[model samples]
Target: MKATRLNLAPWLFLAPFLGIFCLFTVWPLLRSFILALQQTYGPGTTEWVGLHNFRYLLTDPLFWTAAANTGRFTLGSLFVQLPIALGLALLLNRPGLRGRGFFRLTFFAPSLVGLPFVAMLFAPILEKRTGLINATLHRLFPIWDPEFAWMQEYVMSSLILAALWMYAGFNMVYFLAALQNVSKDLIEAAEIDGANAWQRFRHVTLPEIAPIAGFVTLLSVIGSFQMFELSYILLNNTAGPENRGLTIMMYLYQSGFVVGDLGYASAIGWVLALTLMGIALFQRWAARRYEER
Candidate 1:
């Protein structure tokens, strides 16, 4: 009886969490999967479609456009944004740097601002003629075009730049923490072996912080893939000219909410979920291989 009661006690403690998880997470996921297999006409109208939605998604041109744009953004975030973030973190992590706290705060401040606010702020800044970016460039270089169309032509570039501004600092925090945790002994030993600054970083600092770097990369990928609000708001709730700024999540939103095709949206959501899971699995496998090396 005592052993049974002890087991029951643990379950009793877990009951609230399990109930909440089922109600909110598990149930919603199951329902979404079911909904993905059905065609919805309205709030209450649905017809069994089986694999039809997934089949249609494969041939959808708009979906492919969104996928391409999203892939570009993800690549930009992984390569450009992450490198800059690590550089900033390295700079800030230096010992005896003046006003380190102030610099850190300044760099991280943009992340604290809400996405909507950041979108609003950068929208006018990236504008032509009267915009901050073009105006400054034109002022500095007389030959520069002040009327350059950033929002229209360079939609992905504009989105990538804005994301860099907002997220670079946030990602820097993770790198900074990882840097701090890196062993000074290993760094010093590498230096004693006549290794230069870059060599020491490559041999010691990088290996030490690799796990954190991988984590940040995963986070950036997921966030970039899920991008919607920033692009939507920056492009003024449209997909920009020629649908250049259209992202997967944005397409999902348009399908589910705007076009009243909840079934198709659910299908997109599952695709996204599966993609993320695959990426995560790949990362894990790669990490294991790297560690073995």
Candidate 2:
């Protein structure tokens, strides 16, 4: 009875979180999954159509296009943003890096400024003909095309750049936090053993931050899959010229809301959820392996 009492308090504390999780997250996911395997019935008239929606999703050309674009975005962000953020974090994590807090705050500020604001802020800057980037390039390098339509010619690059601007700072903050937690004793010990700066970081800093890095990687992957508000607000929901910036999430919205294909959209949603779950599991496994070593 006394041991039961001891553990009861923890469960009592957990009751709220568990209740909220089931109410908001778990329930919605189950409902969505069920919706995925069924037919599209408006609001209150869902009829049984087992695996039919999934079948259509698998065979649909639009589905393939959205899936491909999502993959490209995820891989592109992983390659371009992660390395740059990590490098910046490493530099800023130095013992006496000047204005560290100021830079950190400045970088992370954009992320906190809301997604809609980011789209509004960058839309004009990426305006095909008169955008600041092209104007500056025209002045500095006359070879650059001042007439380049960002919405058409450089659509993928424009979207990726916007994503980088919005997300790099957040990742930088994550890396910085993880870097700070690295044991100074380990670094000092490595230095005393005549290790070069590169050696110390490669051996100590990287390994210690593996779990955090894994977490950020998973988040980045999931985020890439779920990207919507930015593209919708900025590109006017078209993705761009030839749908270059069209992500899967946007496609889901376009299908459900624009095309009125709720059943198909639910199918797409389930696929996305499965993909995110797989990536998360892989990251968890990788984190465990890194920690074990």
The lDDT of each candidate is 0.93, 0.83
Q: lDDT score, residue 3, model 1?
A: 93
- Looking at model 2, residue 205 earns an lDDT score of 85
Worst 10 residues of 2 by lDDT: 37-46
Off by over 4 Å in 2: 1-26
Give me the displacement of residue 247 in model 1, in angstroms.
Answer: 0.3
RMSD of each: 1.6, 2.9
Candidate 2 lDDT for residue 110: 74
Model 1 lDDT tens row, 20-110 = 9999999989899899998887658999999999999999999999999999999999999999999999999988899988988999999
**lDDT value, candidate 2, whole model:** 0.83
